[model samples]
Target: MPIPKVQKLFQKTFFGIFSMFGVIGFSTSVLCVYTVDTHLSAEYESNSRDIAKTIADSSVDILLNRDLATLQSLIDQFVEIQGISYIYITDETGTFLAHTFVPGLPEVIRQSDPSNTDTVERNLPGMGDFVEVGSPILAGVGGAVHVGMDTGLVALKIQRAIGQQIYLFSTVFIIGVFAAVWFVNLAAKPLGELLGYAVALAKDGAKAPPSDSLLRRNDEAGQLARLLLHCAGFTDADNKRGVAAPGEAR
Candidate 1:
């Protein structure tokens, strides 16, 4: 029975390594980006919630006395905190008492249910989107404090983090591809050189020794080459025995 020719082994190995690394790299990069996105958004929302709650606690007596100046000054200090877009305080009846919105409150915010004391999302006019968090003043008896946390800034931060991740993963992937190619070629080139030798020995009964490089290889291919040389007496000494090398190309 004839030995079947192995076709495209090099291509198969290259692509197999490429595909494995591609899938792993893609998935890992996606996971890292997702983790960063979630962590930052959650942290921003948590900070907003805490600030809202603190403002509510501080504004209890002030709101009850309708102390607008002190309440505005109290909220002014927090606006400088990164990701803080705006802060507004309201009464228990959901009436807006003090706010940082100079032009006026957006209707999107106005339409939101201030009674629902929880973190929510809002888009203010000309200010972009925000993660809005509400905390009840005096535990819902005095009023509520609503804080808008800037989401655009959070998105920018996430983008920067994810960009670094992509750069790192891409570098690793490129290096892996080069390694795969080199390794596959290292194995395949020896076999390619042996193709003609195999055909001559198997079909023509010719015994001219294989190429020096093939015989000198340190891998399994080299071992097989030396073994064939021994079995068939296909050595330098045999070549001098007046037996001609096969007409086939090597």
Candidate 2:
């Protein structure tokens, strides 16, 4: 069937509104996801820092005593813990004492001077990216321990979950908007026709005949039809009372 002009207009308006709302919702969802991810990453990094500090402090006495076996065991225990990628110890002379990675010291710290106690170095592979945390080992202690944690897998999982949630919500929102638009168009169809009829009657400069179909409705459309019928009745009565037509009377 051919679509009514009113229905077509309603569809166009509905799509325009839907597109605008969809864009806004998508943007807001993306912003929210980014903000949440940033906060989560920061928290994860902070937790990693705390874990690194604990490992450093717990081994301080062991390093001071030059207990190589105890320190190696401690490093082994730490590696066993999940999320920890690599752990290594360096002496005052920058010598590679031991490392969980078994590949010796990272290039970033390998070239640095032993005398410089400025910053600690860290490198973690297979994670989203590398992160560095600084902690100085006292002069008396043999050397500072570097702990590396990989957050790549964790970050990926978080991103995936956020994306899924956005997709689900977008689907629901689209369905809801379309459903509302359909109902609004259905409810407005009759009123729209009545409005067109009124406009036509005004242009024609004549009273409209009352139809049983128009008077049967008990809604706003019905009230409008009744009002129109009353106006037609009054015009006919005036014509019978010797009143001229609208233009003639003026």
Candidate 3:
């Protein structure tokens, strides 16, 4: 069966309005995710660098004096810090002096590349992701303190942030779509009423709604209704004509 005119208008308006909301919600969600992820990653990286630098500063005197016991204790304390993979110190000749791990001390640090004042981010074969920071010890010893921090926590934090954004945006999108559909239907109400008035006039002649109510509206629907009322020309004498055309009824 062919759909009624009012039904067609309602469907078109609801879908058109809802589709616009969907596009807006999707773009907003994507932009929010990108902004949040970038901010979180940068914060994690900065924190990791700061931790590495602090450990280097504390280890300076211990490393220069070759105080193995004190150096070992410091390394163990730093390793207790959350997200620190390991803290190790090397001699001027690149020989491991003390370390947090129980392997005693390796003859050589396989991934050691010490910089004078900065930390470098790198991905090692077995270590996953790591930030390698180095600082020089200046108590008459010519070695550097190296701290390796794990980046798993950074990735984990980013993932959780994105998940939260997904939930938040999904809720907003759903509410927006429903609200858009509702407003569109509300706006179409007068048109639907006008269509009903026209249908009734075609079938029931003088039984249609009074012209005064529609003429009060001042919109296009009101104009159309007024035209229909003019054509019908309801009159007290026309009632005796028993629903015939206006001219014939007169």
Q: Model 3: residues >4 Å from true position, as ranges?
A: 1-26, 101-111, 115-118, 125-127, 139-141, 199-207, 210-223, 235-250
By the lDDT metric, which is better: model 1 or model 3? 1
Let me know the TM-score candidate 1 reaches against the reference structure.
0.80
lDDT of 3 at 111: 46
| Regions of candidate 2 where Cα sits further than 4 Å from its true position | 1-5, 8-16, 80-83, 102-109, 112-128, 139-141, 192-220, 227-250
How would you encode candidate 2's per-residue C-alpha lDDT over 33-135 as one tens digit per residue?
A: 7876787666655655665566667778887788878888888887776666666677766676666765555565566554443333344332235444434
Which has the better TM-score: candidate 1, or candidate 3? 1
Model 3: which residue pairs collide? none
User: What TM-scores do the predictions have?
Assistant: 0.80, 0.66, 0.69
User: Residue-wise lDDT of candidate 1 within 128-222, one digit each (tens)?
Assistant: 99888888877788878989988899889878887887788789888888887777676777676566667777787645667777776666676
Model 3 whole-model lDDT (C-alpha atoms): 0.64
Task: Give the alpha carbon lDDT tens digit for every residue of 144-178 in model 3.
Answer: 67777777776676667767877886797778778
The number of the candidate with the highest lDDT is 1
- Runs of candidate 1 exceeding 4 Å displacement: 1-7, 200-207, 230-232, 235-250
| Each prediction's whole-model lDDT (CA) | 0.77, 0.61, 0.64
Which lDDT value does model 2 have at 79? Answer: 70
Clashes of each: 0, 1, 0
Candidate 1: residue 41 lDDT (0-100): 91
